[model samples]
Target: MRLFHFSEECSIERFVPRVKANRTNMPPVVWAIDEEHEFTFFFPRKCPRIVYTRSEGLTEADNHLFFGLTSCNIVITVETGWYDRIKKVSIYRYELPAESFQLFDETAGYYISTETITPLSVQTLTNPLDLLMARDIEVRFTSNLHPLREAILQSSLTDFGIHQFNQASAQ
Candidate 1:
């Protein structure tokens, strides 16, 4: 399966999870469902440094299991798939117009999960409604001012375009 990541800069040859400004001490990696989601379009995703495959077609029960094993954030689209691959994944970058990024409702709640191990990951995202049906999974959505949203609003340039990605072999 092919995973995608986007960035404003073109220097990203490798997809490495980055430390958010609030949590610089940790070394977790993250990615989004696709460019369609608002959060993924606004932020960056990275593959870990381990050997694992992508987790796609997750059911509500599967989400509980996955969330229990590792920390993940929100779920936006039901079709979104996140991989646990960590073998230095290569990236193929494409240009995305800034207008492609459509923001979701900020007033709605969002999920936030985190893991501290080799498959270090963070799932900061918009609510994927299907994942909320699981009783065991606590889907705590946030309506606060997130860092990414702040960055988007504060930027002076409006003609910005994001660098979207695909696997190296596919390109």
Candidate 2:
């Protein structure tokens, strides 16, 4: 399967193993998302979002509560405040060979490699919202993401990703 690394910076030539500022205790590595889960990363790097999909054995009640009337298999919710930034930013998708990566998180489709990697190609996603629409994923904007974030944390919706939740707006 193909793996991808998404970033706002476009001039990246190669990715070197380095410790994430937030997780210095973890070993230095290159991180990439498998194609199956890359859609969640199609936004400004720090935009707070909740991406979820219906998993096996999901109850009808939970489905209706979490997804409502959406027919799309996946839904991404974000705080309304990030909309302007999301529209202004250009996201780059770096396609990397999957040889050296190991599965880090199955649900998140995260893979890690200790070796440095050079991207096979980089794609510029000019319109992130259109990308989501073309993928048939529902994008929901809410004034506050706290309520949904809290509910999803306590939810049976096990297949979910909460990206940069701390950066979300207070209201």
- lDDT scores in order: 0.30, 0.92
The worst-scoring run of ten residues by lDDT in candidate 1 lies at: 45-54
Clashes of 1: 7
Question: In candidate 1, what are the lDDT values of residues 29-90, reduced to their tens digit?
Answer: 44323332333333233310111111454455544532445444432211112221211222
Q: TM-scores across all candidates?
A: 0.22, 0.95
lDDT of 2 at 65: 91
**CA RMSD (A), model 1:** 18.5
Show the lowest summed lDDT stretch of 10 residues, model 2.
149-158
**What TM-score does candidate 2 reach?**
0.95
Candidate 2 residues 55-140, lDDT tens each?
88677788989988888889999898889998888999999999999999998999999999999999998889998999999999
